[model samples]
Target: MQLPGDPRIDAIAEALLADPGDDRDLEAWAGELRISERTITRAFRSSTGLSFAHWRQALRIHRGLAMLAEGLEVHAVSDQLGYGHPSTFIAAFRRVMGTTPGAYADQP
Candidate 1:
C-alpha cells in the first residue's frame, strides 16, 4: 500500500499502527500536524489514491482481524478498535471479510 508522503499523513499512519483503536479524526490530526483538514484530505487522497475515511476503515478492519485471532471478544475488539457500537464493527467486518468476527475467530 502506498501511503501519502506527507509527514502529517505518515504521522497518522504511525499513530494508527501503534494504536489502531485511536478515535482521532482528520480534524485531530490536522491540529496535531498544524495543517488544515482540507490539506490532509487532499494530500491523503493524492498519494494513497484513497480517501482518508476509506483508508482508515481498511486499517481498522485489518487490525480487528488480528485482534479477533488473538482471542479478543467481539465487543472488546470493537471497543478497542474505537467502534462506537459492536453492531457497526460486526457489520464492517462482515462486509470486508465476508464473515462475522465471531465466525472468523472460531475458525481453527
Candidate 2:
C-alpha cells in the first residue's frame, strides 16, 4: 500500500535497516534526508506498521539471531549489538522473540 506521494518513508526504512543499532537523532535523520521529523515518523509507521523504536529493536534481535547462528556467545552478541549489558540483551531478546539466547543457540 503506497502512501500518496510519500517515498521519503522508504528512505527512512533503508537508513534504519542499514544501521539498526545507531541511536542517531531523528532530527539528524530528517535533516540528512531533507525531510521533516513528522514526515519521517509517518513514513516509518506506514511502511513498518510499528514505531521506529520497535522496528529498531526488531532489527537488533535479527542481528542477535545472526550472531547466535555464527556461534557467538550471548555476551559477545550483546556486546556486538551495543547492548549495555548481557542481561539487558537477554531480556530484550526473550521479550521480543519468546526465547532466550541460550535456547535459541541450542535449537536445531
Candidate 3:
C-alpha cells in the first residue's frame, strides 16, 4: 500500500537503512532533502508511526545486533554506532532488547 507522507521521508528512511552507523542528525538529514527539520519529523512520525529519534534508536539497536552477531565486542559496536561509551550502548540496548549484548551473543 502506498503510504501518505512526504516522499523525502522515504528517502531519509532509505539513507538511514543504508548507513545505520552514520551519525543521525535530523537537521542534516532534512537539509539533504531540502526540507525543514519539523517537516522531516512530521513525515517520519506520520509514515512510520514513530518519532525520528525513536526510529533512529531502533535502527541503532538493529545495527548493534548485527555487529554483535558478526563477533564484534560491545565496545567496538558502541564506537561503530557512534555511542560515546560501551555502557551507554549497553543501557540503550538493554532498554530496547531487554538483554545485554553479552547475553544475546551467548544464545544459540
Candidate 4:
C-alpha cells in the first residue's frame, strides 16, 4: 500500500500494515498523534487516494487474502481482522474480491 508522505499518516499506516487488526480509529490516532482528526483524514485522502476508513478497510482485506492463502478459515481471518462478526467480514471480502472467502480460498 502507498503511504502518505506525512509522517503522522505514514506512522498510522505502518502500524496498521504491521498489524491489520490494529483497530485504532481516526479519532484515536489523531488524539495520540496530537493532530486534529480533520488533518489526518485530509492527509490520508490526499496522499493515499482514499479516505482513512477506506484505506484501513483495504488494508484489512489485503491481510485477509494472505491469511486465506495460508489456509486459515474464513471465520479465523475475520476475527483476526477485528470484524465483529464473520458475516461482516464475508460481506467485505466479497465486496473487494468478488466472492466469498471460502470460494476464494478454494481457488487454485
Query: By lDDT, who's the top model here?
Result: 4
Ranking by TM-score: 4, 1, 3, 2
- TM-scores, all models, native as reference: 0.85, 0.76, 0.83, 0.93
Q: Give me candidate 3's TM-score against the actual structure.
A: 0.83
List candidate 4 segments past 4 Å from native.
none
Which scores better on lDDT, 2 or 3? 3
Model 3 weakest 10-residue run by lDDT: 1-10
- Tens-digit lDDT track of model 3 for 13-87: 676677666775898887777889998888878877888888877888988898899999999999987788999
Candidate 3 — which pairs collide? none
Report each candidate's C-alpha RMSD, comma-separated, in the order given: 2.0, 3.7, 3.0, 1.1
Distance from true location, Cα of 16 in model 2, Å: 3.6
Give the range of the ten consecutive residues with the poorest summed lDDT in model 4.
Answer: 1-10
lDDT of each: 0.85, 0.76, 0.82, 0.89
Best to worst by lDDT, what's the order?
A: 4, 1, 3, 2
What value does the lDDT take at residue 1 in candidate 4?
63
The ten-residue window of minimal lDDT in model 1 covers 1-10
Clashing pairs in 2: none
Model 1 spans > 4 angstroms off: 1-3
Writing each residue's lDDT as its tens digit, candidate 1 over 1-108 gives 334677768988778877777888898898999999998898878878878888788889988887778888999989988899999999999988899888888888
